[model samples]
Target chain A: MRVLLVEDEVRLADNLAAALRDGPGFAVDCAADGLSGDNLAGNRCYDLIILDLMLPRLDGLSLLRRLRARGDSTPVLILTAKEGKQAIIQLLNSGADDYLAKPFDLGELIARSKALIRRGKGQSHPVLSALGLEVNTLEQTVRRNGVLVDLSPTEYRILEYLIHHPRRVFSKRDLLEHLYDYNWEHHSNVIEAHVSNLRKKLDAAVPGAEPVIETLRGRGYRMAVGPEHTIEPG
Target chain B: MNQVKRSRSIAFHLIAAVLAVELLSSLLVGILSYGYERHIHFHAFDSILHGRVDSVIGAVQDAGDVDDNVMLDTADLHVPKDDIYEVFNSRGELLGRSPNWTGTSAPPAIPPHRHATFSEIKVNGREYRLLTQQGSRIVDPGDPGGGKLRHVTVIYGAPTERLWRAIHAAVQFYAAGSILLLAVTGPLIAWLLHRGLAPLRQLATLASRVSADSWHFSPPASARTTPELAPLTTAMENVLQRLERSFTQQRTFVSDAAHELKTAVAVVKSSLQLLGLRPRTQAEYQAGLERTLADTQRLEELVAKMLTLARVEDTGAAPGLPATVDLVQSMQQAAAELETVAKLHKIKVTMESPADEPVMVALTQEDCSLLLSNLLLNALQHSPPESTVELRTALQKERNTAEFSVRDHGEGIDPADLPRVFDRFYRSDPSRTRSTGGAGLGLAICKAVAERAGGSIALASQPGQGTTVTVQLPLTPNPDAASQLA
Candidate 1:
């Protein structure tokens, strides 16, 4: 899943972004200040936005307030050094999903981000289940009926996005945004390669398997969850 | 709503006081003035009544014939409209009376040859003033023969309603006048008070704008300025100055602390990332672990110093922490404990008084140690090798004060930077502060400890010369010595 991180501290933000991007393969876009973060949030789509309170042009609290006022329901997690109860209560009342104080561990930050994204898609656990198949988010592995199946990282991420969000249409731009960070120079065509490869791998795994990740021609992609005759007895 | 309450505002108090005094004095003056005016009018009216009596008697005597017959002439004398009279003979027989009294109710017949007297009589539901003139008079004015005098009594009755009417009118006018004055003066006094206190309102407006972020404070000028508000404005300006200074220091403390914490965290994070980036040999892994341990150790020390700074700054002269301790003893103990560090650095530490005289202060023993320890540590670390750090203790007996002063000979601070040397995280050479293992919070803690003990700390230094730091605390006398003296 992709996320947006808007924090002012350069070193902390850089390391956090690197960890989210290369470590767990969460596509993260970093904005150093509030105004630019607001602009990027409004123009593009991100599954979750990590906001910091103090910023250069506009403050994070006001940005969150304005963002929610415009009816954008993207889950927001606040990062702040302001420990006052009044500030926390106000931030929460102003539509903040959760908050973490400064000097927190990067690992804890990543876990919280993933949890928010998972809950936003209405999933119950880190492992997504659908179509008699299971995708393990933590192990980056896929399995059909208790048998392990190999998949590339990119293919796993795209399927991971679709498996978590079943029966939803995602345009190529949406898939690319969900899979890649804002810092990447993305051509929407890159998502076509990953989706087709994922479709091929899912069919090849079974003797006579239907395409699971179905592309709705001229639209985008949706997880195909249709009633089948039966699973072949192996 | 009509009930009165004790007001807290100065403007309300002033206006109420002025109105109360003015209202009471106005009522008194109005009553006195009305009574005086009536008294004067009554005195003048009495004289006029007596004159009318005398004129009527003269006319009667002049109209008298050779016989004892009284002929009253009422033509020449113009009697008042409200006056009535009657003349009586010696046998108490009525001879003549005024024309106004001919048909009206006659006054009572006063006895003839009685002394002239005046009285009040009521006739036909009206009050009259009666004057009885009794004396001897000639029967005929033209007779040259000496004749015996006849005693005649003249009873004159005058209506008293006119006098009361005049008095009533005067009293009514005075009451109306007082009511008018009260109505006008009440609002006038209120307006005057509001105008008088306008300067104070301006001062409050100016003071309210003084915040931690915005520090501009200027007293009101021109129309809003007054002599009575000058001292108040000056006091507020001084308070604002103090607040601004503290707020600036707090902001600096925050930024400096945040930078220190972030740098420490970044060091450990980067070190771990570099080690975990690729596979390494067992020895290299051990070396990397040792480096990370060193960084973590520094981080722990930094956190500890920050906590010490916070505690020292937070401790007030609280009831839970009150204990009287000997200052010299604490200072000497702290010095003795730090002697190892001093020896390691080749520094000489000496105390002027070695517990010979008890110099007591108002802080606890541990607090005194903390203050002295921080100061002495700062002095020792800044001093050159083989240099001397002297500890001096003295009691200013008259002021009941105890002082602990630390003097260090080192490459002293520059003159321009001397004032900020006690600031938290202040380093003369920013690069060497961490290398020297000083978080720059030593002197700041020393200042805080001294202040929390109800004392003050001062520092003086010059470039290339020695520096002196002084902690002056209020002295508390030993109870044993005091009891013996008593």
Candidate 2:
């Protein structure tokens, strides 16, 4: 998945962006001030935005308010220094999806970011399932009938986005838009390659398993509904 | 304590002055009224005595004979029981007297054509007011002088006991009236004073309610205040506003400190977690461990600076530490200690002191060293290579203070950033300070130390020219410079 981080502190922002990129398989773009962050957020299509409350040129709260006023509903997770209860209440009221105070655990931050992205895509549960295959968002791993299935980071992004809205057909352009930030020059064939790899992994992981991703004619991909399945607890 | 209390009680003093003035003036009025009433009573009694004496002369018409017989007629007159009368011829021979005249001699009779002579005399062991008069009958109407004149002297004496009794009763009434006037007005004055001071009492209540937990104090605008207390309310409000501002500033400082510390710890924690994520080659492991070690060192440095700042603030809060420090000696020691750093940076450290006597100040030796070393180290960090950093000490006897200054011939701070130089963790250029490994707390520590020593610190800088830091500490018990504590 694509992510955007807006923070003023140079070292903290760098380390956090690096961790997310190397560990969580995300295309992370960072902005040092609220002005640039606001500009980038308006122009880019990212799955999530991590915002710091204290920023130069404009504050995080004002930027958040403006983004929501302009009807941008990308999941927002705020990074705030301990500014007391009143500021926290104001931030939550101003369209922030979640918040993590500074000096927070890196594992917890990554977990919350994935959960927000899931919830933003109309998936209320932490784990999504299709035909006995499970996408555990909290553990950031997949399980097929009690067996581990490893996939490339890009393949995982496309699969997770598709699983959030099961059975919803997304064209090549639509998947490209959610899979890349504003700086990327995406090609539809590139997404085809990732999808092919993800299909091979899913089929090889469980023998005789039904294919979860189904391609429609003149359309893109969908998490196939071969049999009616209910969401199971992970 | 009583003397202090007496000085503070304005209400009591006001009432006391009013009572004294009221009582003294009332007493004078009472005395004046009594004197005037006595005059009126005596005049009326004297007039009555003269009138009675005049009628006595009329009663005498050369009784028995025209030559020697002188009688005051008592048959046709009803004499007062407390009064008596006597008559005498012009030759001073006793002629006729009233039956109540028991004294051997009457008051000397008056000559003809003379007004009544009133006198006080003791007669029969009783006090009497006597009036003497002279009158002639018709036997002297046809004569020119004394040839055919038959003149008689008449004296009338009236007891004054009854007149004094009435005057005494009126005097007592006047005294009682004065006391009654005070009784009616005393409490009314007290109530008025109390009502007038209600605003002051309300202000006291409002001040008492102010604490760290509660800052809401609403002064009563509708409460009445006199001109004297109006300023008091305004001054109190100003003080409360200042107090609130300080509290807010302190809160912001604590929150900022917490944020800095949290960020430091976060950097270290995230770096270690990421390094331990996967197995690596021996060289890569060494590199990762070294990187983690560096992060921990920075973290430790930040924590140490925070602790130093906290300790300085705490010391400033409680100033009971007794100490004696020589400003010049401390400056010399600090300059010597920075010799290695100066040599490494190719900067020359210079020390200057003109006085021979020790400049004793009220700060401990360790604190004085900390203050001087911080200033000198800051100067060294800012000074360019081959530049001179000067540390000097001087006695400012005229100002009753000892001065210590560290000046550097280096690029100075911008005018915009000069005002916030002493704020904790504030840096003019964050990237530059990071490269220099300066924690941005040197100037703040110096300022705190100076203030705790009953002194002040000031920085004067010209952009692109140089910078000078001057710390002036008041001397302890200077014999010739006693304005140190002022």
Candidate 3:
């Protein structure tokens, strides 16, 4: 999953971006001011955006309003230092998906970021499933037939994106956009290599298990769906 | 504990003064009317007495016997039953007397040359107004030209008890009229005064309702237009507005301080949390620790600056700090302390003054040093490399003030930011990082120190030219120096 962070404090922004990347293995993009944040949000596609209320050039509320005005439905998680019930109500009413006050726990922030991304993709549970395969989004791990499977961070991110949109055919470019931020270089062959590794690991976890991923000719990939796939409670 | 005396109500005082004047005037009118009435009644009584005496003399007639003497005609005489009279011929012998006369005191003897005399005499223990007169009557007027002329003296007296009663009745009438007038008008005056003073009462009620939490002051329209209450109403409105402004400023300051402190703490906390996120090599760990240490130091600097601002504001309220420090010496010490910072920035800091005399101002040494250091540091931060920051001092003899100014040749402030530069925690550029810009409390502290010492401070800036801050403090008079000069 890819996410965007808009914050003004240099150290706080750096720390939050690092935590999101390391904990959940999600690609994170950061904007230091409201104008640039607005500019990036308008031009990019992301599953979630973490915004700070106090910023230079344009305030957080104006940027949020502008984002919503343009009908961009990306889930926004607000970070604010202002203390008051009225301010919180105003933020939520202005299309903020969730809010966290300043000096928040790094662990909690990462957890919430992952949850927003999952919900943004219309998945209710923390763990996404397909035909005997289970991907735990919170821990960034995979299992097939209740057997743990080891995978690289890139391979896991590709598998995570495909499982979130089950049965939808995604081209190589779509997968690349969803799995990486602006900081990463995108090459169509890179997506092929990661997906190939991810498929081998899932099939190897249980020798007799059916394949959990399918490739359509000329259309990149989709999660394998069958009567055996059932979502588990988080 | 001392008890405060409750002030008297204005309405009560006004009513009392009006009633007093009414009662005094009533008494004066009563006394003057009584005297006038008595004088008129007495004059009418005297005229009636004189007429009665003339009637008595007319009753004297000639005696029908030889020797030509006049005799009193008892049958033809007419007078009041309470009156007494006597008649006599020129021989001084009594001819006749009234039937009511038991004259224990003889009428005063009248001189023959006098025509009449009137006196108040007591006869038989009763007061009388008596008139004695000499007159002539014609006896036998049928004779040739006229009958023989016979001169006679008559004395008549009337009891004055009824006259005294009439005069007493007149005086009583005047006193009753005055008392009645006072009774009818006393309450009327009181009610009129109360109606006239309604605006004042309304003004008091409105003023009494004002408090710090609520600053609403809308005086009654009548009060505003009334000549007596207009100035008072205006003064009260002005005072309330001033108090509200001061309270709002205090609230804003507290909220801003809280915001700055919270942001600083968040920075340090996030830095530490980021360092502990993953296991790393020893070298990486060492670098992370050093970065976190730097974040903590910035937080510490913010907290210290906040405390300094609070201390300066607190002491500013209490007066009478000893003005023992020499301005020149304090400036030198401040400049010396900041020399290393200037050297690092590659900026020149220089001091200039017209004279080398010691300029003593009303401030303590610690406050003087703090003020100068804050100003100098601000100048050094904004000054460009190889530029000069000038510190100029002078004694303004005519104004009895010691003046100093700090001028920096750097990028000056925007006109919009100049007005709020002395406000606590106000930064002209919101994007300036904490490392490049101090916590924005330096100028605010300098202003507080300057005002606390009975001094004034002002700032002037142009966008491209430069910025200059001037401060003036009252100079402490030196008696020994003055004597030496003399």
Candidate 4:
């Protein structure tokens, strides 16, 4: 999964980004000011946006308002130091999916970020299962027929993104934007290599199991949909 | 508990004064009217007595005797029943007398030149007014060319009891009128005064409602227009507005302080939490520990700055310290103390003074150092590498102030951020300043220190040229004495 972070405090942003990247294996992109954050959010397709209220150039509320005005429905998780119920309610009313006050536990932030990303794709549970393959979003692990499956962080993220949107076909560009942040150099073939590796792991996990991932010649990739691979609710 | 004595209301005092003056004037009027009435009554009584005596003389018509003497005619005399009279001829022979005449003192003989004489007498234990007069009668008007003069004396006396009673009645009427006037007007005056002072009472009620939470002060139109209350109403509005502004400033400062402290703690907490997320090699763990230590150090710095700001703000009056501090010396020491920081930033810190004489200010040594250090540090932080930060001091003799300033040739503050540069926890560029471990309390502390010493601090900056922060402190009146004591 991919996420964007907008915070004025450099150290706090760095720490949070590191936590999200290591814990949830999310491709994290950071913006230090509200103006840049707005620009990045407007142009990029992020599954989740972590916003800090007190930002330079423009405040977080105005950015959120502008984003919502343009009909960008990316799930927003607000980080605030303001200790008041009124401020929290205002943030939520301003198109924020959730909020966490500052000095919050790092573990809680990661958990909530993953949950919001999952819910943003119309899933409610932390684990996504399809074609006898179970992807635990919280633990960043995958299992085939109740057995552990070893996968690279990149492969795990691609599988997680594909599983969240079960039957949607994602082109190479879509996969690149969804699975990688700005820090990564995007080459069309990079998505191909990661997808190929992810498919190999899934097939190798259970030799007789049906294919969990499907590829169309021109339409790119989608999760395999058949009688054998039934998509669970979450 | 000590009970405060409630003073009399203004209306009460005013009404009492008016009533007192009215009572005194009424009494004066009563006395004056009584005296005037008595004079008129006495004049009328005298006229009646003259008329009665003349009638007695007329009745002394020719007795037809050969001597041509006048005799009293009791039938022709007409007077009050309580009156008495005595008649006599020129030879001093008594002709006739009133039956009530029983006094031992005889009436005085009328003077030859005087026509009448009047006096007050007490006869038979009764007060009487007596009139003695000389008169003449024409005994033979047809024989002589005019008339024959027959001289006679008549004494008439009337009791004065009725006159005294009439005068008393007039005085009583005046006294009763005065009492009635006082009774009617006393309450009228009090009610009028109370009504007239309504604006004052309304102003008091409105002023009493002012508090810390609510600064609403809308004086009634009556109070605003009243000549006596306009000034007070305006003064109260001005005071309340000033207090509200100060309260808002304090509230903003407190919230900003809380935000900064919380953010700092968050940075430290996240760093430690990130380090504990997974097992790592010894080298990776060592690097993570160092980074976490740095984050904690920044947190410690933020807490220390906040404390310094609080301490500087809480300083009231003049603390017990050296009476005077030399601005030139303080500047030099501050520049030297920040030498390492200046070196690290590749900036040169220089000091300039117009005179060799010490510019002594009335500030404590610690406060002087604090003000100088904060200004120098801020200047150095904003200055570019290999640039110069100038520290200047001068004694402004005309204004009686000691001026110290720091000038840096760096990227100056934007016009928008200039006004709030000294506000607590307000940073011009949050991301840039946060990386440098600036909590934005340095300039705030400098301002507090300057104001606590009866001084003022100001900033002037250009976007590209540079920025200069100046502090002016009141000069000590007896600098030499203070230095000697030190």
Question: Which sequence of candidate numbers ranks them by DockQ, best first?
Answer: 4, 2, 3, 1
Interface RMSD of each: 6.5, 2.3, 2.0, 0.7
State the lDDT of candidate 1 residue by residue for B221-263, as single tens digits. Answer: 8322577777777777788899889888888688668856765
State each model's CA lDDT, in order.
Answer: 0.77, 0.80, 0.82, 0.87
Give one digit per residue, the lDDT tens place, for model 1 in A44-149.
5788999987665677999999899999888899887666698799999999989887666666777788888887877758888777678878777898766677
> DockQ, in order, for the candidates?
0.05, 0.45, 0.44, 0.79
DockQ comparison, 2 vs 3, better candidate: 2
What digit string (tens of lDDT, one per residue) describes model 2 on residues B46-109? 9898788877777876455646455656677666867887778777767677787764364484
Candidate number of the best lDDT:
4
Q: Determine which window of 10 residues in candidate 1 chain B has minimal summed lDDT.
A: B477-486
Which parts of model 3 have CA positions greater than 4 angstroms off? Answer: A1-10, A13-17, A20-137, A140-234, B1-5, B50-58, B63-101, B109-190, B276-288, B315-321, B324-326, B355-360, B394-403, B473-476, B479-486
Residue B205 in model 3: shift from native, Å?
2.9
TM-score of each: 0.59, 0.76, 0.80, 0.87
Output the lDDT of residue B14, model 1.
Answer: 80
* Residue A126 miss distance in model 4 (angstroms): 3.2
Q: Proportion of native contacts found in each model?
A: 0.06, 0.45, 0.45, 0.92
Model 1: which docking level applies? incorrect
TM-score of 3: 0.80
Q: Is candidate 1 or candidate 2 better by lDDT?
A: 2
Comparing to the true complex, what docking class would candidate 4 get?
medium
Tens-place lDDT digits, model 3, residues B194-237 = 88888888887888898877889999999999988889889888
Clashing pairs in 2: none
lDDT of 1 at A94: 96
DockQ (0 to 1) for model 1 = 0.05
